[model samples]
Target chain A: MGEIVLSACGLSKKYGLSYALDDVSIEIERGQIFGLVGKNGAGKTTLMRVVCGQSTLFSGSVGLFGHSGKRGLAEARTRVGFMIEAPAFYPKLSARENLKIYCMKRGLPVSENLDGLLASVGLPGVGGKRYSEFSLGMKERLGLALAILGDPELLVLDEPTNGLDPIGISQVRELILRLNRERGVTVLISSHILKELSSVATHFGFIHNGRLIEQLSSKELHARCSDALSLTVDDVEKACAVLENICGCRNYKIFPHNTIRCYDGAVRPELLNRELNENGVGVSSLMREGKDLEAYFIGLLKEGRANAQLY
Target chain B: MLNYIKADLYRIMTRPTFYIWPLLLAALPAAMIAGAGGMYPAGVILAAIPALVYAAFCLMALILTEHTFREDMQLGLYKNDMAGGASRSAVYIAKLITGILLLALLWAVCSLSCIVSASYWLGGDSGLSLLKDMASLQAASLFLRVNVFLAVFQAISIVFKKTSALILVYIAISAAMAYAMKWLGAAWPGLAGFIKHIAGFGAYGNFGAAAGAPHAAGGVALLLAPAACIIVLAAIGSMMFEKKEF
Candidate 1:
């Protein structure tokens, strides 16, 4: 409902004969951190590149901040900051010097608050160190520093916490959250670390073999993955009536083969089971079912692979 | 484009190689003058100055192009530039212009040394006059040759992304092309003349006598060849660069 910060529609990018991105469409609204979930070579980076204008598309369009077309997208991209793959800088130049180059290229005053920006990324006084001499964690921190240099409205970061230590990872996670909460910056981030992503992402798009298999918000994904009291009953109609009328259960879903799942209504499993059985809706089986984000993504990939084979 | 240019200037000027290369270039005249040791005519050394300067300029161009482009390609900095909203043509042209400006600085240092040496050895009035004459005679041709070499090499660097491969392939092609032109010239005289004129070799060979009585038609054609080559080569280079994916 908020202004769309990034909208990529029907994006397809082909390398040789295979598709790096196949008919992918994604949109991120203002202040949303959309995590691109996929294994390696699953089109996450390619999709990010296409959105950032680093890679040309075979068939599709990208609109940023409601701006489309060549000239418009170009002008729109200036408002976006991106760090794709490795953080690239002159190896000989210090982190501060590299950030200054970015400032100059973006036409900002060379005197922009670079030290403050570096400090914000947890790279406070190390700005004078050469990039070549940086640890991978430091490099990633500087990359973050560069991405936030111009106070961009949108940040397209690919694996921003890639080489960080555990504390560094938490720092980056906190930084992303703070940026989103404070400055309202829209982020399109991709990472192999799904758990880390789950902690920060407001929404997610699971990509598999160059196709986006699913897109859901954090709330929706939680609802799908949340613990559920599942029951297999003899009569589906009777079971639904008994659950609704007697047990005071309001949130539940009925599946095939007379199976039912109750979620989010505080319906105790043993009590519901006995109530259903007592109400003449023979309860055949009862158990709890749930999944974490990783399990859900793996299961989605498998399902997608099977469907691709079927097609 | 101006932003990129400014940034590139700041980067190159900060590096010590920018100053070192031109100083080496300026020292060429002194080195050659010491080696000549009063054996050859002063005019011969002066005439030979452009040739020595051209060779040094070529090396400088090669190093400059490698410094300007190859490092970026290897490190993937171009991705940062293009993603930051700089047009591809702007990045390419900005680099080319930076290389030219750096080359111009080298040219100025070398020219000043050549003039200073010429004045010291040949006396004031006559040395100044002769230096002025030779500069006018050689300026356009030398500038075009260096520009064409830089532009062509840059185009090659863009098209061929690998640094070692670019160097090996460029050297092989240059050697092969030189021999091919030589053999073709042996077979056909007019073609040889045309090749010589276009390649600027004839201008260098005839710099002394040709200064006062330049053939207007031939001179125009000579300038046009390299000038047109630069424009066409730059156009093709920029086009390829624009379509290149990070």
Candidate 2:
């Protein structure tokens, strides 16, 4: 992994009687596309806001580019870009005019690489059109262009693809990939589209009820999601011995209640059942199961809920 | 800070309303002079200077309230400025400076128009001396009074972040205070006299005094009183803005 671009520790925020964020801690490394997944009101937006210095008054510390505290965070934020909730723009101004204002405010030379910036976001011919006339997707694209105005090292996007069409979605996905691969910009994105995120995210953090339930790399997630053959049998020691010695199958896990799960999908379930039966292992049930990212997320949330019930 | 000011200036200047409002205000003095049969005594025009100057200041305050403070906050321009790495205090100061500069521009246009109209129609150099004296005093007093209004409005804008509500509250409270002071002065002269000295607008009390006598000391106090209020109010406003979330 590269250097840690953002690290939030023990973040706790409350509004009135309820806590929006409850001791949430997260870290994003350079060049990584970290996906934050959570249900509505699960503190994903709150956490992102705090990290980007939008919402303050939280009880914790945030380190951006290895800098912490008010002064440090303000300095570090110069190198960070973000689009939170909805895009903000002057309704009366044209796209070019609005960008000109933004560039001037950022202390960049106005009109410097402006056309290219607009073109990069697929807004080449629409510079003269007022921002209020643009559609939702177009507004989102402009927002993205504004966020990347200074070529920020870190991009914090909240539901960037929310208002995009299918083609726009794919374009944004490719854009994110190209930015990460070519510019090495670290991205922190939150979305409800699991399949879309699964294709791009390098790491995943699942949040439930204002708490981070799980965090894992894409490789680890995939490894945990591999297809498995679940088997119920008597004499679990003999079943394991038969599977390893007789069938030459070593990738399997034994559970309580004399159950075993074999992870080698290449080996047929029938072959394993036959081998276990011929080895005098009494098999009660056998089933093949596979999980995708969405199913895995659901399973994790369920497990989190079950654990919560216990406490 | 310069970058923020530049951006704000661009935004303010591009709108037609910015130029249109000032032109309209400049026309008022010409219109008044024209309505008086295109000729009046120098004393009549000189006596009207204070009222016209006050009108200009009021218009400037309305513009600042509507254009700079309220519109920026409503459109999330302040957030955009902060997002671009501008310190909150810098943004606040930039807005103040930009508003003052624009108002000053408007004041110049209106004052020049009035002077030109008087010179063209009234046709007298005797009243010119008194006009010049009152004009300078009114200009100085107007600057201080406008700064006070802008500082107060800017502070309110930072705290409330809502333009329409703030303006409504400000106008309502100002009217109420004026009426209350008038009533108090009529009911108990001594009490009102004491209260007027410490009021926020107390600094401008010397405006009339300076107009009559044109004293250097009163003029200096006129400038310093608002300057002091601006510093204290701007500091408090800046601290509030710095701590504001979003």
Candidate 3:
């Protein structure tokens, strides 16, 4: 909706022949939080690492704030604030002191505005209390506090709600929303929690086998991951032939008892049954399958796995 | 660069290891003095050994570097380190400076111990004049030189991300350099003088010489040589680490 703050073009990273990230491309607009969702080993962390310069690039490039050179990565990174993987902090330092350390290192104008910063993350009265004493959720909140130091323009968090309790997740969610809506900072968050991500993400990017399957707004994902009907028959080959030739319902799958989740919900079940019966192909049952994000993710990954075995 | 340096310092200051090392070094000469009671003159000289021990302590203290970088790298601290106005060069330099400061503090303790103890025992009637002697001055310079050498060695350990290997390398510098120099002397003439000179001894009985008479070697070069070595090693380390991906 606002400026395109992060533009990744042909961004790819490979380990040996297997690509960790394969020619992935995406654009993140300013003032809008972009959620990057993928399964384990799907390259979300790898991509985040490359963008922030903790990891290297095998090919292609990422343009952050319009600066695009190997040497320029350091300069461009100044505008981006992030908490990577599981966040770490000075275990001995108090929350207020940690902020001071962060701010002092950035050479930003030193402020005793520690209270406001801590309060933003709901960590009031955290002064003089060492980080080791904080709970996992409290530590995560403090990590968020450090990330927001000096009011960075774009905040990148990898599983910021990781290991946090329900209440803690809600706190992080609220904080992210406030930072984006109230503070006007763009954010890029990567997580495997589908439903949780689905709630706060204005946009989504589906990464399958280190490749971009789809990069759409939450509205589009919701539309795509919507409910559908699946039919399971006896022989998948026969089911495919019957569905393709007789019913002309081609968009589907032939696995786990010849299942087909029909995207075209308007298909007539009676007609389909009649054709399959007339064709001598046995039909066991028919049921509706909603857009299960987890199932879709597994399907995409399996497809990739199958493709890999071919080579 | 300033920001990163400050941050590195902040990180170091907050580390338990950081405080422990400095405080130990600061309090060591006094502690030994109190502990030895009547051990007298040798107690002070033994204090010098501890000062040198601190230098070794610094060279071997790769865990500080490892812990800082590992926590950051593992927890993704470098990403934010850069985002907080620190470039790669700044990060590298900050660690470098921090390492040197720790080494310097270690050396200062040793030198201060030498000054105090030598003032008590050797400085009698000679007053502080014994400290001004060419031999003591030479020994002080050698100690400073060792500090720089160890600092550079520690810097390498930080960049390479290996602790045991660097520790071995540091021990070699501390224990074997002099022997290696002696061996080199018997083996060759030009190499002999070079080894003896860099080894910080022309005479075994000389100030820096270990409890015996010594030979003759470079004088002005003695002062300039360690400085040159530090600059060159620092450059090599800085260049390697500046653009290195965390």
Report the Cα lDDT for candidate 3: 0.68
- Which window of 10 residues has the lowest lDDT sum in candidate 3 chain A? A288-297
- lDDT tens string, model 2, A228-277? 98999989999999888877789999999998988886768888889988
lDDT of 1 by residue, A59-83 (tens): 9999999999877888888989898
Chain A vs. true chain A, TM-score per model, equals 0.83, 0.83, 0.75
Q: What is the DockQ of each candidate?
A: 0.71, 0.59, 0.36
Regions more than 4 Å wrong, model 3: A227-296, A302-311, B10-79, B83-85, B120-127, B133-140, B159-165, B172-188, B192-220, B239-246
DockQ ranking, best first: 1, 2, 3
Tell me which of candidates 1 and 2 scores higher on lDDT.
1
Could you arrange the candidates by lDDT from highest to lowest? 1, 2, 3
> At residue B5, what lDDT does model 3 achieve?
62
**lDDT string, candidate 3, B1-246, tens digits:** 666666766676666666665566546654554455466565345435434443444443454555444445444456567555455656765665665565555556654654564555444433254344324545544654654554465456645445567667666664676676668767786777655555433422234342122432445565566566666666776676555554
CAPRI grade of model 3: acceptable
**Candidate 2 chain A: 10-residue stretch with minimal lDDT:** A49-58
In candidate 1, residue B207 scores what lDDT? 50
* Alpha-carbon RMSD of each model: 5.1, 5.3, 7.5
List pairs with backbone clashes in candidate 3: B202-B215, B203-B214, B204-B212, B204-B213, B204-B214, B205-B212, B205-B213
**What's the distance in Å from true for residue A153, model 3?**
1.0
The local lDDT score (0 to 100) that residue A46 gets in candidate 3 is 88
Put down candidate 3 lDDT per residue, A244-281, tens digits, no spaces: 78777767755564676766655677888888788877
Candidate 1: residue A87 Cα off by (Å): 0.7
Docking class of 2: medium
